[model samples]
Target: MLFPYLLKVSLLLGVLTLGYRWMVQFETYSKFNRLLLWLNVLAAWSLPLIPLPNWGPTRIQAEFHQSIPKIAQAAPAVKHKIAAYNPAPTVVSHQRLSSLNQKLKSLHVMQWLLVVYISGVLVLASHFFYQVGGLVWVLLRSPKEKSDRRVVFVRNLRSNSPYSFFQWIIVNPEKHQPGELQHIIAHETEHALQWHSLDLLLAELQRIVLWFNPFAWFHQKLVQANLEYLADRAVLDGGFERKQYQYSLLNAILCTTEVPLTTSFAQSLLKNRIKMMNKKPSHYLAWGKYALLLAVLYVSSAFVAPYTLTLVKLPPSILRPALKTLATNDKVNFKEVSSKILSLGPSKAESLIEELKKKTPETTKAIQPSRSKWVIKKNDALFWVISPLATLDDINEIRNEVKSFDAELNINSIEYDPLQSFIARITVHVNVKSGSSSTAKEGTDRYSPMKGESGYLTKSGSLGTGSVPNELEKQLQMDYEKALALSKKNEPYYFETRLMEKITALGSSSSHAFDKNTLNGAAAESAFRYDGVGKSTDNFLKLEPEHRNSELYLNSKPATFTELNSLSFDLVRSIKIIRDARGKKYMIVYTN
Candidate 1:
């Protein structure tokens, strides 16, 4: 999960970074470009927090950018752990044991990767703090000059290069030309006025967090580079001759020292600086390109954004995937028999119930509980949140309240039916502040109805009074199906329709389901938007110019261009475009 989050940060950085590199690199709008750079960093991290209508490209890479950005950015890989809740019974299958072993091994590897990443962060954080401490010491110990800016003369300082930290401008009078000293002060002052040090500090912190990512460092480079351009333009605009300022920059070039949190005057970005200074001013209309960047960002937000993701953690008993055939196992133990019976699946459970009827003639027919307490919802309204009230008339009186918050359904109905092998228990997972957990169904009258835990589930609605179930798709399966069958074609089932209208809320979600948002988010998207954002990888093949030159991939791995001919864009989760060293491009497609 941490991996995917950071990967999103990295991918977003790469995309906006490339957008800047590809569309507009050099122009005279240094101040505006500097702001864009700042915003790019903010957007990279924050965009992942905001969900859009849907996802955009899985990947948009530049040949020259760092490689790690593509890794987790577009690839949705997670380390999984097997059910460690209950120990395996005496007679476990060899294949099941092997799968558990593999998963445990992967969990261990993921733990180590996390440890290594944390260690890197700690080390870099210490270094970053040390740099900040050094700058702070110099600011405090050095002599101050009376000026509008907080100017500090670093007496007998080792590094001759003048730098600015927050509002303090550090310079040594002996190291500069008498006239050039003013220019240097002016340059450093620009940094102070604009609070450029804050940007460097943010970039440094991101570096500490994303130490393994080369693009993070490059992202910092861009931030610092843009700040320098901003300062250079400021100096030239304020009556300083361009030629004289260029000479001053060249003259100040010495054995420059690096300060992580401070903005230095003699930056080594000379070539780019010269190009930027001479570059023509861009037309105001060029701002339109930024809209394309916004659109691209909006697209990326759909997938990586924390769109209402919820984890439906069914009990491990139901998760065994019918590994062993019911008829094949001869020496089945009591626990194995119960697990097999419970895991028979929804459709198979119905058949198993029928078979039970012939075997036990004493069994009573299943009695339907009072419809009052039952959380019956129509099939089409699967995505809607229903009120907990008994009828539509009660919900209509408080329409405003029902529209905003999910009504908590205190479902306590239970019936004893010997013929009902499945109890049809509904346990909703929510975070109610005052509620206590109780067993959904005890082993009351054997026939072991599938066991599962019900936790509190609500979409930004706190149901302090009772358990609230947001998604009743799986739990209310039988009820929903029956309601659908009862309804007239193209008409709502009157009984359940009037029953669920008040509860239908949260059409789009951004819920956090414990530890598996990506899995849950993807599943929810697949369920709600049957056709998710069509990936653009295969679509690139339709372009004559691109098909002739670009490389292709399916699911992140290299593939021949011909594969795109058979590719179904409808099935794709996302599409990525990568450019290699020779300017050749890569089009990759991902499917669920």
Candidate 2:
């Protein structure tokens, strides 16, 4: 799931980068464009974490709504009746067990992926620190001169010494002619005085974290290019000879070294800088473009993010081999499946039941924080979320508790044949101050990997958004549905939806799913880069970091990572990465 979240962030970078190229890349407003690029990066990283505004969409997919019609050859568990259910017997849910098994297996793959990602991060991080340490070492050993508030480090380097980091301007005065040295000192002084090194450092960190994202690399280049443009402009404005400065730039490039965290006097962006220097200044009025860009990004991000709505759900399909012995016509022992099971000791279970009940139509209210008018009224129906692992005794305790709390609680939500459900689930979704990749401002902290990739926890029961009063309900539903339709096109395809639901449709398939244990803060998602540690059976190889929007070959044929997920890894005989004379690598997977 973290993979999906990071994927969203990277995609945002791609989108915003394209937008910048089209709207502002060629613009001559250095300061405005600088701000624009910063916004682009910040928005891409933070938008996914922000909660949707109240006016944004609030479409609640019926957690238990029948998205697919009943499948052909309905399984027996689908018809088990409640009134005649027998107790003290096992009524195992094949779908539930299958889903659990998938999580257990995928956890291993997730761990391996974490290892790969951490390794990349460490390697890049070490290199970054080493460069920084080198700068410190050189500064300490070299003599320094103070000009105004800036410290200049005069070092003996044949090339690449004229660079600035923070307030420190480093130079090799012996290599440049008097005029050229003047231009170099002025240019690097602009970098130091303006604290341009901070920008480079920030960009470098982003590159390190998202080392695999091509856009991250490109964005860093954009940032450096702009800074150089500004610096060249400064040198010219300071009355330095433009021709001599241009000449000095060309000469300095001969000995330039690529230091990611410093702004050197000469850069590969030479052509772009010269062109920008000569280009007419963008009309001051052009500053308004940033305002327009921001408005558009905010509107798009708000509407584009999926609204997190809680609704009870059932598994709609079985993507893999299921357990044999399903609960057929066994009489569901009503006494065991209820709202309370105290024998497990004081637990979060009762509160979960209460949450589910409160989210029903009659009790539901507008999702606060959002605090909008989304309420469902007078819907007194039976709603329960049963745990698959509950024993027959647990069910009896729940039945007794429900009767004691309110004799008519399950009057409508509970369907008879639905009685013997292995999991009598009544989950409450508390709208806390957390945020996530999904919609809404509450719960699912973007940084909390333990909440699952979706950042959904104790989910199922809608919070506060019950029946909007009278006509308010109808209007809210109508407006929210429109927003929901648009979001469906963009929302990530969370593979776990299938596992979260036990009441599945016939013949449904799911992608690989992971357990919460493997997805932690420091790891999970985007860790698998070019073959991390993984498991391979004789038939198929379960690849981590698969589904990376790339193409691979299955037995010399084109196959998507998604298609590979449903494939049994036990059938994969080998996975090969091969290249032709062109050097374009192709992965060919052979199945046994």
lDDT, candidate 1, 179-262, per-residue tens: 788888889889888889888888888888889988888878888888998998888889888888888887777557656678
TM-scores for all candidates: the values are 0.48, 0.49
**Residue 186 displacement (Å), model 2:** 0.4
Q: Indicate the TM-score of model 1.
A: 0.48
- The C-alpha local distance difference test score for the whole of candidate 2 amounts to 0.53
After superposition, candidate 1 runs with Cα above 4 Å error: 53-107, 150-156, 307-592
Per-residue lDDT value at 319 in model 2: 5
Q: Which candidate is the best by TM-score?
A: 2
**lDDT (10s digit) by residue, model 2, range 292-335:** 67666765574335333332232101100111112232553222
Model 2: residues with Cα > 4 Å off, grouped in runs: 55-107, 158-161, 284-292, 303-306, 310-592
Candidate No. with top lDDT: 1
Candidates' lDDT values, in order? Answer: 0.54, 0.53
